[model samples]
Target: MEDDNISDTDRALGFTIPARHARGRIVRLGPVLDTILAAHAYPPAIEALLAEALTLAALIGSTLKDAGGQLTLQAQTDGGVVKLLVCDYKGGELRGYVDFDAERLAAGPEQPSLFALFGAGYLAITFDQAATRERYQGIVPLDGDTLAQAAQNYFVQSEQIPTLVKLGIARRADGSHVAGGLFLQHLPEGEEGRERLHTRLDHPEWEHVAILGGTMGIDELADPVLSLETLIWRLFNEEDEVRLLSEVAMTRGCRCSPEYIAQVLGKFPVEEQRAMAGDDGMITVDCAFCAQKFPVAVTNVVL
Candidate 1:
């Protein structure tokens, strides 16, 4: 059944299948994704990849332990489609961008797979918690065919947690974008008991749920009319029980502001700052995340 309580777009629903001893999260990104991608006119392939990255970031961010913290997912590659794709999630806000070779992308193969687009690359995930001074990061080789598969590999290889991830992205006739993802993880039983158990391999329940998840098609996942609750029920209703834990709202937001840009420019030498000024005697700074432009006056800046 669909949950009438939550809004239609940019939301995540966390659930647990106690009978299977597994936890999962489903996310729908509509207007938020459209707004983020609309900020820049990227090629169709680049836009799709960015949407996938944003969806993955939200899925991982919703599972963070820290309330006041940020999760950053970055993909660095030496390929024709994209060089760098970064997405950051903080609170309920998400933003991302991509750097690619335009000429190469235009001349490359049509609809290249993730591995082909990011040939021999790495995916890095960083966690920055406000309560702690230390930042944690994990790196994994991008060996999967899709970003979602790579994420699954990360949890299994780096975190040693059995996980399955699926992501879907689509473009509407109006040129807007929509993205959604499903994440399932087997929670650790206990540290003491885990060591005693020896190996934390995949369970039969994990395989069962993963097979059910694979039945979902990209159209169903990315459909704006499909409510997350309905989708979850459709996927796991046959199970003994599926419980909805909580819901989180997501938005399209950037951490860029005039003061922040001014502070960054202030670090440069006076001559360098002057050289950055335009003919109008104002230094213009463009934010890569939101594509917002900030024009700063020389006299107004304190350097």
Candidate 2:
């Protein structure tokens, strides 16, 4: 899709088709994806769900124009095996975690549908601007069997951009996990930045490209041997040209640290901090996203 250089792991590629008035993103997550999921010791079904959510986060998060901004995806259920799920991406740094009832999950089916797993839940996507501290969020129903379908609902309802999302995940013999996803949208028409989406959903160009995109199978996405460049070329080579943009590198990252934890703990009252300390006079704060613990001494920290 670009030059000879092509990334097969832990990268997101952005591209546009001028003639079709469309643009898309492709993400391949390897070691980083493995690291994020393995630390949780989740069941296979839970891990699969999180992998898709994390990959979806990366696909759309990388499109943020502001380098300092962040994208967060959260799913919540009132009565289901999984009570909560959250994932976020900033500057290509990815982290996610899920909270669930072990007993309930153990009794669940070998594979559960979205409604079966969540019962009644909603998925929220939030964009946080680091510079202006502005936050925009959109919430949609968890309708389809896959998270990819939920994302599509978001684009069609909130963004009003005709979109397609496909995700795949596979586990190797070594027990490591890999995930990949594609996000394609019809570029709106108008002046440079002021373009508006085609209110009528039946554009000829979008229909044609979306059909080609729909032909992609989920298995092809999770194939370790398949390069993202090869996949893009296979799908859109019939077009005049595909302009591939720079690739964004993704990695396992956590914002949790001793100093950061202490700063947050400082906001609590001194008596409350004392009650949280262990016999050793230290409070250990655990981060679910990274599976890391930070020890904060009440005496050392201003609480």
Candidate 3:
């Protein structure tokens, strides 16, 4: 299979081929990206970047189907609350956040470059399996300026697999957000298949494919006039036998629970917990991802 026509909408609409007889690929994303980023109050640049990262993260989680697996993409800066985390669970639930210095948003976008915003950081992928399997983690330095390039680098270095990620973010006129992305990877198989696919991907025509794939903007995606199905056909309508696997949808969900928070509170020293709990006899825990606040009474917390 030629690795030339890889695009987000193409796969979002459904692109399928056998991994053995052909290279299997799927790339789909849209409103779900907006849903994840819309829950937060983020600056324009930061919002755009994180949305792109979240799109890729969700796609990865969906594609890598492991009932007990979860993937988290975190980018932490040196001295800012600008930390970004997007977590994906095995069941296709996705949640994301942009932690920032309160004053930073007021100071404006000029304060931090993407690198400085997330200084000296790294990208990590954690995998968990069934039967209480040991978790595996792979971490790599953030060598690229953009998250797309950084993630692509991670696959190249860690898995010895060549891949390409294209992400685009746009601001809507009514203050909404939209994002879309594509991931093209050279699958590990026979040397002949790998070499042929790599050559096509590196071709100049492939650049045109990449360029055109990113032009679908926020307005087009969010507009009711254009749906994911129409968008995909717009790209690869000419292909006769393009098979779309099951359509996967992504939404924001926080894994935090009252029971989970209670366990966390138990980690602190008894004296500290007592001091914070106060005479009001209650503790409030807000989820970092969804901002869902949970208030628990002192009597409810048990060691």
Q: What is the C-alpha RMSD of each candidate to the true structure, in Å?
A: 3.1, 2.7, 6.4
Alpha carbon lDDT of each predicted model? 0.84, 0.87, 0.59
Candidate that scores best on lDDT: 2
lDDT per residue as tens, model 2, 235-298: 9999998999888999987899898899999999999999999999999999999887899999
Give the number of the best model, judged by TM-score. Answer: 2
Query: Which pairs clash in model 2?
Result: none
Q: Give every collision pair in model 1.
A: none
What tens digits encode model 1's per-residue C-alpha lDDT throughout 148-231? 989988877777777889899988898777888999887545211143244355677678878898888888788878888888
Misplaced by over 4 Å in model 1 are 1-7, 190-199, 266-281
Where does model 2 exceed 4 Å of error?
A: 1-7, 190-198
What number of clashing residue pairs does each candidate have, in the order they appear? 0, 0, 3
Residue runs of model 3 more than 4 Å from their true location after superposition: 1-14, 18-35, 79-86, 104-112, 130-132, 190-242, 263-276
Cα deviation of 133, candidate 3, in Å = 2.5
Model 1 / residue 121 / CA error / Å: 1.0
